[model samples]
Target: MAKFKYIDHGQGGAPACMTLAEREWEQPAGRQVLIQVAYAGINRPDCLQRAGAYPPPPGASPYLGLEVAGRIVAIGPDVRGRKVGDEVCALTPGGGYAEYALADERHCLPVPKGMDLLAAACVPENYFTVWTNVFDRARLAKGEKFLVHGGSSGIGLTAIQLAHAFGAEVWTTVGNEEKAQACRKAGADHVILYKEQDFEDAIKAGTGKQGVDVILDMVGGDYINRNIRSLAVNGRLVQIAFLQGSKAQIDATPIMVKRLNFTGSTLRPRSDEDKGLIAQALAEKVVPLMEQGKCLPVIHKVFPLAEAAQAHALMESSQHIGKIALKVQE
Candidate 1:
């Protein structure tokens, strides 16, 4: 079978300038299932990796995609809970941007009942991210206030909805009025226009100067100090990415003063066992939410696989309000 592959990284030029071509794919190995990918969701990590800033961990596949939804075409020996023709969504270590992708059994999540395969593709990356970093690491709980940056992003939108689903008051920052409305629709109690208002000030005012209970911060650098200031007593800040820049000069006083916890995680580098625990939790906890219509995947656009360049362009534009997906089937 033919699959799309990341042929090279383009450091100084546009993402489209980097090569993507169809290539012959091999069959699955032991404990691995070969997925006939129906749809693949594009994420920020894919873009960073393409720019040669982030490379896959040692021994990981060279292909560049983090999530996919499709049917299992072949199952390796010792794999359980799945069979050929079973529809599933999976967190890929790599090789997701292709017609056929291999996934270890632990990383696979079953497609929610009554959900379309394309829509299911959007669920794994965002849900796994929020579940691991926000709920598991930060220990966010009911009745707490949660604030997220880039509320219109795939990760942000998912976090807003899930935090609201589990009884937290949610707030988010967005680039424009349109995205702010989108955030509100996704269950954010308040939306701050980050380009206009200082988010720390707006959040403090919204909370009556009490600050939020947890902050899901993707922006680093200058946002670090303010994020500490925007937290309640014993608050938690979970960092998933540093879109602005990672290095920063900041005071540690707020963290010590407020007893705030600052931490973050990336899914790719984690062990298979850890990812399995997360997958199991998501399948039991979050999948029911989607089945009951309490939470769902939001797609900003779906481009044909051949238009992968355009899909990356749209995501890079920072204008899309939700997940951008690549359609593998007509």
Candidate 2:
């Protein structure tokens, strides 16, 4: 029997909880494909789960990863177009830390040409997120102004590059000058040092007091209303995470006056159908960009699968410029 290595959970900090262990995995069931995982992407939610701050979705695995790239080794009867020996990158509910994992067939996407498993592993979470929030939720149109918080983060960096390639004028907020420069190189039209200046003021000045047409925010707290103030008439605000506390004292006057729209979503709980729609859209719209070298994940570092805790630590330091991934194969 082939054995699988997985990140087992205990209690306390990342290293303690992110312990690696050997296990025997069950066969894939309905529409599920068994993947011999080559690489897995480390996400902030994984760290939160390790810290006991976030919980796995009901009925999902308790392991600590969401996205992976690998080869299909087995498939349930209902799975299609995915066969043994096929290479794919996928969005999973959990369990991606394992050497062998299962994924919904619809959620699996072909690894783009010229991209290896490590680079492809970084795509699903951030790519699916940015595609849904920026294009579907915010409906960001070409030539419009877009502002994203935490620009140097995985999701933010993906959003910036995608928005830029699609003809949007992208603006972003970052903590330091180095991150600001990184944002600029990633195609942001303007970079705001959120620590040195109020982003709302900077946005106002940058847009000649007109403000951005769309705002993608992960930092909540005072950012809730500040996001409102930063929008132009009919602007849309798409919130994905609350890195800061979600609570806030907000004045709704600006929202009402500007006719702004506020919406947010978490990807993990969505039905397979919803994510499948996003996958199809990305295949048609974004994969070509990857093939053309116009868009790709900026990998900051790669860690062995056993060192997931250390990877989480690096992500927490906010020192990495873009994505952090795990090399699960060797």
Candidate 3:
């Protein structure tokens, strides 16, 4: 078998390393399909995997890619609705960053026509995260105000476009003025420069002091409290990650006083069946938005498979304005 070197972390706090002289192993038995990876998206979870904090579950591949887009080369027995030569993207619990990866049929999504593999690779993680947390969990509605932190990020940009396309008012917080502008260009109704202005104040001013109907937050800790205060009546705040440390001294009084609903989730920890449901939702709802060009994936850069370290460095700098992709094959 031809081997494809991948980026991985061994165990406990070690820096990410690449192993090139490795051989591709045979696929395991399951209702799965082997994909000849064309592109893989680099995500924050991948960074966690590289730091040895995140690992694939038992019975899953140890390789560290959560989403990939490519062509199907082989299918397991009893698989249906797909076949060899299909261009598709799917969520993976592990083993995404390689020449080939296995995907359960239920989680596979047909790539939209005319979409490049790199852009398709960028969609699954961000789209699934945004849709599940923002729409499915929070029940965001049309004409409601939706706010997202890290507005120019992979998740934030996806949320902005999807919410706007669904007739909701979209607002976001970005690190700099340039990113704020990029968020606006991506159909955000308003952009807050967290550097120059307090996001709470920006949100208040933007909504005439009514606050937002929903907020998608990845930065936890102190922002947890502020996120609640930033909500409208019956508002929902979905916490996705804690880039600023999870623990913090916060006042939860606002939750009762404002009657806000707080929720959050991690996609990689979810069961395959649940992920399949999210994928089905994406196929029915979000894919049409992509086909109409309303909520397409925005890629910042594409790095070759070998330079995975450099990709992590760029993401660490918090400088990227959209999704970063890895080109797995020429």
Best candidate, lDDT: 2
For all candidates, the clash counts are 0, 0, 0
Please give the TM-score that candidate 3 achieves against the real structure: 0.95
TM-score per prediction, in order, is 0.95, 0.98, 0.95
lDDT by candidate, in order shown: 0.87, 0.91, 0.85
Q: In candidate 3, what are the lDDT values of residues 233-266, reduced to their tens digit?
A: 8899999999997887778888888898988999
> What is every candidate's alpha-carbon RMSD to the true fold?
1.8, 1.1, 1.6
Candidate numbers, best lDDT first, in rank order:
2, 1, 3
Worst 10 residues of 1 by lDDT: 4-13
| CA lDDT, candidate 1, residue 82 | 84
Of candidates 2 and 1, the better by TM-score: 2
lDDT of 2 by residue, 1-330 (tens): 767899887764655567889988779999999999999999988888888988888888887889999999999988876899999999998999989889998899999999988999999999999999999999999999999999999998999999999999999999999898888989999999988999989988888999999999999988998899999999999989998887889888888999989999999988889999999999999999998886799899999988888898899999999999999994
Instruction: List runs of model 3 lying over 4 Å from the truth.
Output: 12-16
Per-residue alpha-carbon lDDT of candidate 1 for residues 1-330, written as tens digits (9 for 90 to 100): 555453333452466754556677677776789898999999998887877778889878777788999999998987877899888999988878778888987889888887888889998889999999989999889999999999999999999999999999999999899999999999999999988999988987889999999999898989988898999999999999999898888788988998989998998989888999999999899998888877798899998776777888899899898999988763
Better-scoring candidate (lDDT), 1 or 2 = 2
Superior candidate under lDDT, 2 versus 3: 2
